[model samples]
Target: MSMDAPTFRVGVVVERRPSKSPWVDHAWRIVAIIPEAIGTEPGHVLGHDGEAVLLYAGARSVEFHRVETGNYRDNLTSGSPGLWVTLALTDEEPGIRLISVTADPAEGESLTEIGDLMVEIAPMPPEIAERLAAFVETHHVERVFTKRKRQ
Candidate 1:
């Protein structure tokens, strides 16, 4: 929440829809990544209008690091950059849990190695893009590539 810090908080919204799957009653997916969810509590149900349930899953921190600027730059520059959200669910649980929100594509993709968690890609909001771009502009260093000598 600090204006000058490398970290900021965002709201995670999830849509829970009744499922036709024989084993599961509902299916959930991230519907939005709100720039600021300062006052909302996690797991609060926003609305349910017969078909889908909208829940303010929680607020999560998207942090920036100098060393990861290159990755951030790559993410921001990509034609379709996204903010990755990771949600967790257990067999006995009724709703999914917000595990994390990340701007690094690779780091987020790596999280898919765990099959149980729901990993989704959401379009990066302008607010987040601005901050990410600023961080990259300030800290990203272009590493020079050198051809290897055939010894």
Candidate 2:
């Protein structure tokens, strides 16, 4: 982790409906907090008036969202809150791929005004999650099932 880089808690927003209960609203929950490196040295540069001019290269911004296994299973079972991840440009600098994880998909939409943003909301890659599995497993609490008493 870079000392200057900022860390963000990634989350998956699930919309779900239960047969026994009313539909549940979109719920955003944290999955992992990771530090992301944003700065990279420009490949080519030219000197102009004692100042280095960076060569322009065509590049697009991208965001990645990681959804935990447990959350994904619940979403599938409930069949409601569609799987979505919030993505936005990092506050540190523009044109850099530093996405902050959010629970609100709307926030991702709002980040791109013209709808040209390239934000990807997909299942959390196993390798990526593996790095933080210990943290999640230690903190995550599994729900216990208990029979309800009849009235």
Candidate achieving the largest lDDT:
1
Candidate 1 TM-score over all chains jointly: 0.87
Off by over 4 Å in 2: 1-69, 72-84, 87-120, 123-127
| lDDT (Cα, tens digit) per residue for candidate 2, span 17-50 | 2234354222222232223323423222222222
The CA lDDT of each predicted structure is 0.85, 0.34
* TM-scores for candidates 1 onward, in order: 0.87, 0.28
How many clashes would you count in candidate 1? 0
lDDT of 2: 0.34
Candidate 1 on 34-145: residue-level lDDT in tens?
8667787777788986899898988888888777888888898898789999998855444788889999988999999998888999999988899899888887788989
